[model samples]
Target: MHEMTIVAGVLEIAHRQAAGAGATRINRVVLEVGRLAGVEADALRFCFDVARSGLSAIAELEIRDVPGRGLCPACGASRDVDELAALCEACGNVLDISGGRELRVLSLNVD
Candidate 1:
């Protein structure tokens, strides 16, 4: 699955960062995943558990969920959205997405 690829990349980065900092191990990794990012958290967690090795073998994965938000341009109303093509409840018009398209590693705890 694509989550394997994503976990590989994340572990690569984590390993590089840990080595660069002369750390013996990676304690934890914090990822920010948005509702509209199209990533499955459970899949990612499973992939991470399978893919991690060496410095990150016992690293804990923490995922932060970000909520999708949108604003109705026509009615100046804001609301929570689940998809990119969400319709505004007030004016029945397409909403301009404001947030929740993020997929990035926020931080890493290393020793």
Candidate 2:
């Protein structure tokens, strides 16, 4: 699905960074995935495995999940979330999420 394409993009960028930095291999990649990023973690992992072939970096990847933060307007609280339907724990009001809906490369550890 779209995860394949997304993984492809990731590889392209990681390849460039690794090559530019004169790193023999990319040891790890840290991605910040938002709760509403609409990306399936399992699917992304599988796609990454398939897409990283023949690249300068060997087939090794480490994924770190970043939880989304939602705002409880009714309660004026900020909370972390893993689900789309987030409710305020203080008053059980529907929480409005402001950030963490984007998939971004936070950092990469290279050799």
Candidate 3:
């Protein structure tokens, strides 16, 4: 599955970062995944567990789900957005998505 590829990329990044910092292992990893990032949380978690099996450095994976958000230039209103329909709640206008499309590493605890 694509989750395996995603997990492999994450492991590679974590390993590189840990090695660069002279850390023998990773204690934890915190990830920020947005609602519109198209990633399934359960799949990612399972893949991460499988990928980190031999890597002693990665002990834990923490995922933070971020809500999709949008901003309306017509009414200067900004609020949480629905991924399917980005509409401004204040004015019922089409809004520009401003957030909640991220898939990135937030932090890591290495030692």
The candidate that achieves the highest lDDT relative to the unseen native structure: 1
For lDDT, candidate 1 versus 2, the one ahead is 1
Model 3 whole-model lDDT (C-alpha atoms): 0.83
Question: RMSD of model 2, in Å?
Answer: 2.5
Model 1's TM-score against the true structure: 0.93
Give one digit per residue, the lDDT tens place, for model 2 in 8-85: 888888888888898887777777777678888888888887777544346465666667888998879888887778
| Candidate 1 residue pairs that clash | none
lDDT of 3 by residue, 1-111 (tens): 987888788888888888889887888888888998888989999888878944443578899999998889799899887584688878899988888898888888987
As for candidate 3, its clashing pairs are: 25-57, 26-57
What ranking emerges by TM-score with the best candidate at the front? Answer: 1, 3, 2
For model 1 the local lDDT of residue 96 reads 95
Stretches off by above 4 angstroms in model 3 are 53-58
Error of 3 at 4 (Å): 2.1
Give candidate 2's whole-model lDDT.
0.79
TM-score winner between candidates 2 and 3 = 3
Report the backbone clash tally of model 3. 2
> What overall lDDT goes with each candidate model?
0.93, 0.79, 0.83
Ranking by lDDT: 1, 3, 2
lDDT of 1 by residue, 16-42 (tens): 999999999999999999999888999
How displaced is residue 88 in candidate 3, in Å? Answer: 1.5
Over 4 Å off in model 2, which ranges?
85-94
